[model samples]
Target chain A: MVPAPSPTPMGRPSPPVPARAGIGLRHPHVQRLLDERPKVAWLEAHSENYLAAGGPRIVALDAIRRDYPISFHSVGLSLGSAEGVDPAHLARLAMLYRRIEPTQISDHLSWSVSGGVYLNDLLPLPYTSEALDIVCRNVARTQDVLGRTILVENPSAYLSYAASHIPEAEFLAAVAQRTGCGILLDINNVYVSTHNLDGDALRYMRSLNPESVGEMHLAGHAVQHIANHQVLIDDHGSAVAAEVWHLYEQALEIIGPRPTLIEWDTRVPPLPTLLAEASRAEARLSEFRQTRIHCYAE
Target chain B: MLSDLQAALRTGLLGRDDAEARAAVANGDGLAPDARIEIYRNNVFQSLVGVLAAAYPTVANVLGEAAFRTVAAAFIKSRPPRQPQLSAYGGELPEFLAALGATRHPYLPDLARLEWARNECYFAADAAPLDLGLLGAVPPERTPLLRLSLHPAVRLLGSRHDLVAIWRERLGGGGRAQDAGGEGDHYILISRTGLEVQMTELSAGAFTLALGLKLGLTLGRAAHAATLSEPAFALEASLARLLSHSTFTSFVLSDPAEEVRS
Candidate 1:
């Protein structure tokens, strides 16, 4: 068995992000984050947004990084692509990682590119032996290059492939077991996929290895109609759905308190609105923490 | 087999070869496989259209949303982004616009070019400005041998139409397209200073000199080129202006041996 690679040493020792709620950092909220310095536990930035050589966004992130521990959530890695990972993209990410030294880093368990054409959407993969082998290889290679174990988020799939024989939870668990990477369990994604595919969200959550879950994502999804059927779209445009929040509470109960993030990308509300959402998650986290403390005392 | 599946999916998402690809997807939940794939198809086009709209705001403003979406969809079909970075996706859009034959609006291509340059300038690499003292330290006699380097954020755009006027009007929230006046050649200089990317209209001679310098010409050669283009070109004044704008990042004394070999 190949030994897991050690975590890459950042230039300076980064402050670990607390197991509390945070908000996904957006461009419009940069000023508020800097000026007001909100009381969120941390900020999570899309790794691809800061890949540019220079920009106000990069500068803003630099200032914001000083005040809060950051997590780099990437969408462009295409970890499940059959072509494997692109070396150029990896190098660009490495450059940004070396500069920012984010506390946590992650990408999705979906493919976005094939045959050199990047679709820019998290397309689902067939959960067969072929795909599992490819994903495990890609995850291992990415960890080896980044010199750190990255958290792989489960994709909010729109469709299922006919060739998929393995369950999604088992595939993710197997990937983590092989690559020594953690899972960035997206609760909203599970809710969305289950609603669309007529599956059991709670069973899927229960199937995951709780120790392998390092972070959790809670985002707003839109509901759309198709042939008089309701399908949830992971648009991240509005407030977190009540059903998703209920599922999130259940997840906290099962997975324990993790670094949860409130992701509102499209039609993003004012800073206070996102903060309110983060506050809701933080309330639940605090409740769980208090319960655990009381139990230990007893 | 994975490659074939991806190929089929790509074609299907673009609304081509739907039947074969739809068969690969499991159908259930009262939604046809084709309808399910259509969601991704619409999303792929709409999201990419949004990217182009954001990058080329003036173009989208000039063409209006519906027409802009039409043109963007065509462009995406013809030239999808190969890289994952969307910011660097639309480099060929100006050429695409030219090929689209917007003969009525002749300046559309140039306006798009300007917008593309601004898009690039916004994300160009950062570099420290060269110390003016270094240029001052060079002996007057050896100044002619000095080669100046422009910042990565610097871009020069020469257009036959008055693109700056059209871009300015659209950027200022002018909903209606006004007449851009008579056609005349324009020289524009784009550079990022501090945090803001600034666009300035430059004289023909200044543009010539900047272009020459960007091509690795020595100060003396670039000045000669500038004067050749415009007899009244003031080399000292233009150099002062360029330096004040922080256009150049560094300078070096050209190696005589390398110069001779070239």
Candidate 2:
């Protein structure tokens, strides 16, 4: 007789995702992933999109999970909310994580919900001591419930707050240091936020604790002119910018190789285009690995 | 101070006032603080509006893009998503549309309800259908005490308009609005079989039986309810159809001993 399903982790010993490049799994590309079963290292899906109890998408993801390691990249955890994490949301995510058994689980450092209203966009946070305390508490609570560590990604912001005394990188490091959580560094966000806010992207990259970075993300951003000033919006619509690619290489040089994901949420191109982007990231990762080996030999 | 900052940001994004929130945002090189905040406000509303459009394509198509945007923006402002799961966010939209009373087509609300039902069915939980052989094993006398549970994905919708036809037409089914004829009742049974969420129009008897079964009535009582609604209701045929469609997930025999204890 089949055993009754339990809420505990299945303890299925699946292979861990290699420190190679992967693609963000979107609904448009599910059938392609199923049909082709590409040679990519892993697939990351937005956790909120797959929170449904059951569907073809969930079924497809389950089928695909067998072939590739999956990562749950959440955009709606609202980790920076002052009111703390929502129990219901956390419970649902926990349920999903139990089912999917993702190789990695991550959300943004920014808050998306406040006062019971979910804005559905990653709003920037003021990196004050108080904000840091709240985020760390929320992260701890999240990790405690999921029974696993979650990586928090940095946000791509159009604006910063006057109240923020601590730097973004410092705040992220503090959260990791305090909560024992890892960081999923999105290189495009670092490039965009620093460019828009007039900070040094390289400096921010160097400030982060490399050991805390479990994964990296590379996505395209759109440059928009607001009030005659160039503002790069993290739209994830087009090809990865050359500048962002340069920064990714720089980040690899600093932080070493980690599991990287190519996120193209808006105007998602055909599977081949995303695959090509993943290939580009994989090539860089390989090149970085080779350079490291050569340097070690020398 | 954190609460104040978040409150100001909320007001700045959703309300007309940005003065308080603008003070909190540090000004960039050349862009005004409010302009920067405007980008976030635009993103928030646009993304939520896009979600509503995706959930209710028929509503968007019927209202047209410009009008749909107006409605979506209004809906977002009034009933912002309380939960992070956006797929389940727009369930209240049918009532909101009905309250608007701006459409020439009064059937729009029902169409929206149908779409929402379809959306719910699309994401509803998976379940295994009841085994016919299990029913065969039960003594014939005990069949009347068996309470069948509908599948989690099964949804019954009753509309005063020919909602199926209207929804199909909006989905490019090629039927004109007039072809739906005058107002008539429609009973729709939506269930997910494998990967597909299938919608079917149920007969009066079958609808009554399904509705009764959903309400926790036993098989004999549900058949009685079905026959009461439609004299020609054939219990065997309806049972066969429901079983074939994988409507009922499982059933429990209502024990006389347990009933007495209760």
TM-score of each: 0.96, 0.94
Which pairs of residues collide in model 1? none
The positional error of residue B107 in candidate 2, measured at the CA in angstroms, is 1.1
DockQ of prediction 2: 0.76
Please write out the lDDT profile of model 2 over residues B176-235, one tens digit for every residue.
Answer: 665354566778898887878788888789999999999998887888999998899988
Model 2: residues with Cα > 4 Å off, grouped in runs = A1-10, B139-142, B173-182, B255-262
Worst 10 residues of 2 chain B by lDDT: B173-182
Instruction: Go through the candidates in order and give each one's DockQ.
Output: 0.77, 0.76
